[model samples]
Target: MSERRYMISGGGTGGHIYPAIAIAEELKGRHPEAEFLFVGAKDKMEMTKVPEAGFEIEGLWISGIQRKLSLSNLMFPFKLMSSMLKARTLLKRFKPNVVVGTGGYASGPLLKMASILKIPTLIQEQNAYAGITNKWLAEEAQSICVAYEGMEQFFPKEKVVFTGNPIRKDLLEVRSKREAGLKHFQLDSNKKTVLIVGGSLGSQRINELIAGQLSWFEAENLQVLWQCGKLYYDRYAALETESVKVLKFISNMDLAYAVADVIISRAGAGAVSELSLVGKPVLFIPSPNVAEDHQTKNAKSIEDKEAAVMLREKDLDDKFEPVFKNLIQDIELQKKLSKNILTLAKPLATKAIADEVERLENAVR
Candidate 1:
């Protein structure tokens, strides 16, 4: 029997990249002999992150269209044509049994080419609101896996699968790791620990909000485990004190989530999914700058269900103190948040996505 070959493409942000990695990791576990290839946009984080995750990746000369006219927009047509030609060459040479796209600039070209070639293709749409790339690919996609309900509004009903977003498998066992997490971060096991993550690159607004509220956190007797992100670490590292721990990034997120009694985070699709699985009380400050204002929508979906709280960037100055104070004091509210968020978790998402790929591959064969 010939070895199975798979191609996965998604990048630009951890939101897209991590899910693709999780699905690939799951597929690798199930089919150890499978040959894997990752296609990502050149100069995007995936070019580095994918290889670091132990996979061969090819970078395409592709980028997302800027909303406003720019020099990059002038080069769009040429880049698209070049990417498509390169994608054709890659597809013809590798002959993958299946192509999976998690949605990014690279995914648009690679998966579009795969569909044109009549290869089995699956797209994992992570956000509650679909991105332009995923929306464009929906018609040709064999399967459209999504994290939230009502995705049929964006894609064909028949092709949609409510598979949720793929998250780190280690997060699955957070319930038992609280002690280890506290020890790992060298924090008090007795004090309530609040973890703040603003994504890999960090959010400037979120960093500023946390900076202004250090005294409030101290007054509430909360210990802080802050991942200020690599982009703003130099600016925020000076704020670290005995009660607050600031880091460039939390390489061990499983431990960070484990130790967190409450979490303040940006409402990125990946963070929403991981926090759901972590089953902690979360206050989401959705980045206002995102396209389609999707982060607010992601936060709203959870907020609607009473699973978490959404604090808009504009409201931070007025609402942060009272909201944080009340949330910390209300043990019942914490219980409700934790229990409700856990109900939204799909821990087996990675396995389910890979299963969909296998099913599609078998049907085509």
Candidate 2:
């Protein structure tokens, strides 16, 4: 009978932020009168992104601990304490009925405080590998929504729910946008198009790999649509030509996915989930530098299912040409990959996660 209030926290990368936004959007659609608040690490992209998505967000003075000895690592305690206090203040002021965490620096403190206050909390783990923040908060969470199986190793088995990762609503229609995508990118329908996405900030290694293989792609008569990320656009912009389209970032991802015959991508959980829905043949190059080598684990999960192919960063130099050559030359393999990945897609993931949130809300009442 009364308006519902929800507080969501996730950040540090687009992978975490986007899923948090998707869940919030789903909840908003279900309860038009609901109030939502998002908390993210200060200076992180979520500060800008969440607002652009039409949600108010607050920032916490927190960041991940660096693996190496550094000034920031030393400051971790102080930052954590400050963030915890701030989170407590926010929770007290807002008095949300339910809190959701999507795994990020800010979520650690915010969700922990919410749990201590005895408010219902739910945590969403996008990666096959659990993030440190989510793992720490798992004990206090009422529900744990996960994108991959075997997450019981990270959280309580009874609390785990396999809902998959939440993706952009627009991406759901990529299959119907083939012609519009080709026209928007000005590509030839006759030529095979390879879409390369290296996450929001772009991957230096992926950019280098693409640049080195440009001549090979040209020789094979393949066209490329590359999202080089904002950080590396200038370096690769000069390499663009008639058959290659270079972009700093892709705002119209549905079109990009629609035009792609084969996709080369990073194996972040969010990307993997969206690619599954796009139903495109994807070659994943998981970043080795990530925490606990989780990106590799993320890619391996799909590869294990025979839904996609994964090329490790360390193996790229030696295996890329051979693996890519085989993939492109085999039409049947492409079709098989597309059909298999789509089977793993959970198009109702957002709604399912929201259903859990609603359950928590109802329990609180």
Candidate 3:
């Protein structure tokens, strides 16, 4: 029999990249001999990250339309035309059984091209507020997998599939990682560990607030695992306190989530999804820079359900420490947040999305 072949496209941030990776993992596992290819935006994180995840990736010359008129907007039409042509060439050469898009600007051209070629196509959208790229490609998509409910406002009602965002498989077993994580970090096993992760590229606002409030870790007898982010690492690298471990990046997020009693994080769709699986008491600081202010919307979805607490970036300087310290002491509130967040975990997101791809592939075959 011929080897099964597939192409997956998603990038820009970990939100889009990780879902595509998870689906690729699922497809690889189900079909051991399958060949997987990734299509990503040139100059985006996926150009570097997809290879790090052990896959071949091709970059397209496509960019998003700027909201305000800019020189970049003028070139978007030409880039789009170029990307479509390149994507078509890639599809014809790869002859994929199916093409999957996980919601990014790169996904727009690749999936749109796949649709034109009459190939099976799938999409997994992580946010409640869908991006313009995904929304425009909704009709071209064969399956639209999503995390939050009420996504019908953005896509076709009949096409939406409510499979929660996939998380790193290692995160599912928090109990097993707790002791090991404490040991690995060389921290006090008895003390409460508070973890602050600011997404992949890191959040400037979250990084600043954590840096300024390092004293609280000692005051509360809390052990801290602070991912300071690469951008701000140089500015704060001089602080080497015993109780606080400042890292440029955290590759072992599973262990951190496992041992953490509290988590301070940004409200990226991907981060929220994984944190939901960890089910810790989370304090969300949503970045205002994102398109459509989707990060704030994502934070509110959890906050309104009492699954997490929210602080706008502007308020963090004045209010973060007080809110965090008070939350730390409120064991009851912590329990409520933990329980509510756990209910939102869809650990099987990869498999669910994979099943959707297979169903669509079979339809055309």
Candidate 4:
């Protein structure tokens, strides 16, 4: 047999990029002789992140159409055309056995072109609500890997696979790192720790909410481990005390998860999946600004399962304190939330998705 070649495209955010990388890594492990290539939007983070993961990547001049009228929206047609031509060229040159797309605008043109060329394409949708790119490419894709249920409403039910989002391998063992995490963070072992992460870049609204509640947290005898994001670290730096450790970013997420008794986070599909593995009670503050308010949908799905709590940005000012107070005081609720969320975790998601890819490859052969 000839060497197997795979082309994967997903970008724009860490949620999409990480899952793409995870799937690629899993496939690489299985087929050590396989060649992998990643395609992402030219100016997007994946251009840097994909290569950082030790995979060669090609960038397409593509981006999502903005909701509001703007210069970029006007240029959308030309960009799409150019991207389609470039995608066709890449496909012809690479002749990949399988093309995988994790949701991002960059994947749209590439996957569509792959389908046109009669290549098997697999798309991974990471949100409870389908993304525009994934939705558009649904019919053409051979398999639709999804993290949420009821996704059949958006895609052909026969093609949808209930494979959860892929998470970093290191996070799987976070449960065993409590003692080491405590020592690393220099926190009192007796105090309950609250971990706040507002995604990679951090959410301004979440940062503000945390800032306003600092004194309240101290009064409740909770130690705060705040990842304020690189952009907002300077503004929140002076507020940090011995009990409140404010960091721009966390390099050791396993330790962070291990030390956390309660977690506050955004509801990106990737984060939700990781939090489920951590098995900690989580309060999700979904950003309302995302496409189709998908973040809210992501949080609501978990909340609906009684696996986690969802607090919208609009309700934060009125509901955050009461909701948080109730959650913190009720140990039973915390345990219930933790146990329920873990039930939603698919620790072997990367492998399962890879299995689907292999199936596609075998079917074509």
Best by lDDT: 2
| TM-score, ranked from best to worst | 2, 1, 3, 4
lDDT of each: 0.92, 0.93, 0.87, 0.92
Which RMSD values do the candidates have, in order?
A: 1.3, 1.3, 1.6, 1.8
Q: Least lDDT summed over 10 consecutive residues: which range in candidate 3?
A: 166-175
Which ranges of candidate 2 are over 4 A from the true structure?
Answer: none
lDDT against true structure, model 2: 0.93
lDDT by residue for model 1 (254-327), tens: 99998888899999999999999989999999998988999999999999999998899889999988997888
Per-candidate TM equals 0.97, 0.97, 0.96, 0.95
lDDT of 2 by residue, 198-268 (tens): 99889999999999999999999999999999889899999988899999988899999999999999999
Worst 10 residues of 1 by lDDT: 1-10
Q: Write the per-residue lDDT of candidate 4 for residues 237-309, one digit (tens) a residue.
A: 9999999999988868899999999999999988998998899999999989898898898898889999999
User: In every candidate, how many clashes are there?
Assistant: 0, 0, 0, 0
Decoy 3 TM-score against native: 0.96
- Please say which candidate is ahead in TM-score: 3 or 4: 3
